[model samples]
Target: MARKHLVTHPSTAMMIRDTKAAEVAVLEHHERLDGSGYPRGLASADITPMGPILLLAEAFAYWDQLKVTLSPGTAKALADSAFAFADSCLLALQKALIDASPHTTPAPG
Candidate 1:
């Protein structure tokens, strides 16, 4: 988690113009409800709203790259885990994938 703190140091935070939004986004991206994530080891309510969204997006992309396919099932599996992701973000991702699929009819949101 040292890396996390490094990003917010006076020298580093200045690089981001000391914007609270940017700082929080960077911190929350690695935070998890299970307290297994890095930097602050924050859990549940401590995490910002954008945190889960960024985590989900990164996880989905990484999983797709590693597996050589973007599997909606994998997205659902990750979202359904105990990571404490926002339900709305998961639902949005699901709807997006469904809408993009040629065979599956996009469910109403």
Candidate 2:
């Protein structure tokens, strides 16, 4: 079966083959900075870089939802709080992307 097709049905895939990546992602999902994470209970340093990025993305999405009922500033504030928990490297990369983004307004003439 194709990867995309299998992904559409998680249970079927689980019954059919090993779910190593899924298991690892789940382990990483509940991971924390205080060594309270699940599966292996990996801490901040123990978790890989990808874990924090996932956590940040989840926070940002939830923040966007909060924006629906709150002010834009409030939403941005929530997003910033989410960013605060991320690795500095991720924040720097995000800043670089924002600085270099084509959607950024050009300098005034």
Candidate 3:
């Protein structure tokens, strides 16, 4: 199934509520940071914040579905291949995770 199908699929209609953010995230999910993706060629700042998050999650899910055991290095490689701005997105994700972790202590600046 094509990436656009995820946005227009009948099942998704029921599962996804009517919200601008939700719509943007779903519609832009397949968009790439380099403007090489389908449906719309959004590059860099043109892509919504949620778009990259969804893309990253989708990439990991795809690999997981294939039973690929992704070590940190493998995951980083995969993200680099899948996203043009993978380093920035990965860093942001890591920061988000660290901030959310109860056991994490703020790093000395």
Best by lDDT: 3
User: Model-by-model lDDT, in order?
Assistant: 0.65, 0.51, 0.66
lDDT of 2 by residue, 1-105 (tens): 322433344454355445764544434654665665544667667787656565656655554444423334544563465233454644544454444444446
Descending-TM-score candidate ranking: 3, 1, 2
What candidate 2 gets wrong by more than 4 Å, as runs, is 1-23, 68-84, 87-109
lDDT value, candidate 1, whole model? 0.65
TM-score of 3: 0.62
User: Residue 83 of candidate 3: its Cα lDDT?
Assistant: 60
lDDT of 1 by residue, 63-92 (tens): 444543435675567667766566677676
The C-alpha RMSD in Å for every predicted model, in order, reads: 6.9, 8.9, 7.5
The TM-score of candidate 1 is 0.58
**TM-score for each model:** 0.58, 0.44, 0.62
lDDT (10s digit) by residue, model 3, range 1-109: 5654865743464566666677777777788877888678888778888877877677655654554544557447756764664676666554544444454478999
